[model samples]
Target: MIHFEISSYNPVLLTNSPLNIGVVETTLDALGERLLVIDRRGKVITQRLVPANNKLAIIVPFEYTVNNNLMCILLDDDAEKDGELVDNVKAAVIDMKNYTPPV
Candidate 1:
């Protein structure tokens, strides 16, 4: 299993009214076939089966709002569990904040 986290280098970005969140692997290993994202309320917001890849960068796209406040819990599903099911450890936590470009 590989550990993962929000990329400290470029955690969150706002552009053209969309929020882009960056997730990176802490270890140099293959990201399994599944990736799970959940909210702070323990609600599974999005879950999908992704192709096996070793790339360190994973970007999650979300529609932006002015009062956006999100806590994203990422899980690496090594067990390949299907939709809305998490069978692996918590890989990372992404804390989101409202974005305001420099004036």
Candidate 2:
């Protein structure tokens, strides 16, 4: 599972309105939080007992290096609308160290 802190959220754009999401390290850990992200291949990226807001919380496709794997994540669900559902973008970084897709 990938791990991330809500405090690390970097707003992609400026906004005059206050962010609806509470600014706290524990904000993503509340009970009943059901955040999820699916990869381009449709694999469910897993996460610990973490959480988030009404937004779909999707991360734009980006590349990263982890232990020389040179892997890519942040699956694009192609949602009809933005921030509609808690899909791909669940974690800032997905650790593929031991990930094995289900058969």
Candidate 3:
């Protein structure tokens, strides 16, 4: 499983939003929470009992490997007109350090 140690600097709720991702598991615990998981395809998985209001540190695990291939879909009009929006973009990969969860 792919483990992610998540830390939110701001008070952000893991809800269905443009900026927030979803959890994957459906089991609840004494803390009444579970990990929020999101895939590259934008699928959200979450625990059923974690109140939608509680926000805390979560560990997200994935059953499969992640594909980092970046794909961009442009509108037909933009593509035909040779829009400048796509010209300014470049894709690259950067190494990220694993964040250890606090005890």
Top lDDT prediction, candidate number: 1
The alpha-carbon deviation from the true structure for residue 83 of candidate 3, after best TM-score superposition, in angstroms, is 28
Alpha-carbon local distance difference test for all models = 0.39, 0.32, 0.31
Best by TM-score: 1
The window of 10 residues in a row where model 3 has the poorest summed lDDT is: 83-92
* Candidate scoring better on lDDT of 1 and 2: 1
- TM per prediction: 0.29, 0.22, 0.18
| Segments of candidate 1 deviating more than 4 angstroms | 1-28, 54-103
User: How large is the C-alpha RMSD of every model relative to the true structure?
Assistant: 18.0, 18.8, 19.9
> Tens digit of lDDT per residue, candidate 1, span 65-94?
222332333345565432333233233323
lDDT (Cα, tens digit) per residue for candidate 2, span 1-103? 9996786766677444332211111133223334443454545544323324422333323331121212122222344333323322223343233333222
Which regions of candidate 2 deviate over 4 angstroms?
Answer: 1-31, 51-84, 87-103
Error of 2 at 19 (Å): 30
Clashes of 2: 2
What TM-score would candidate 1 get against the native? Answer: 0.29
Kindly report which residue pairs in candidate 2 clash with one another: 37-88, 56-83
Prediction 3 global C-alpha lDDT = 0.31
By TM-score, the better pick of 2 and 3 is 2
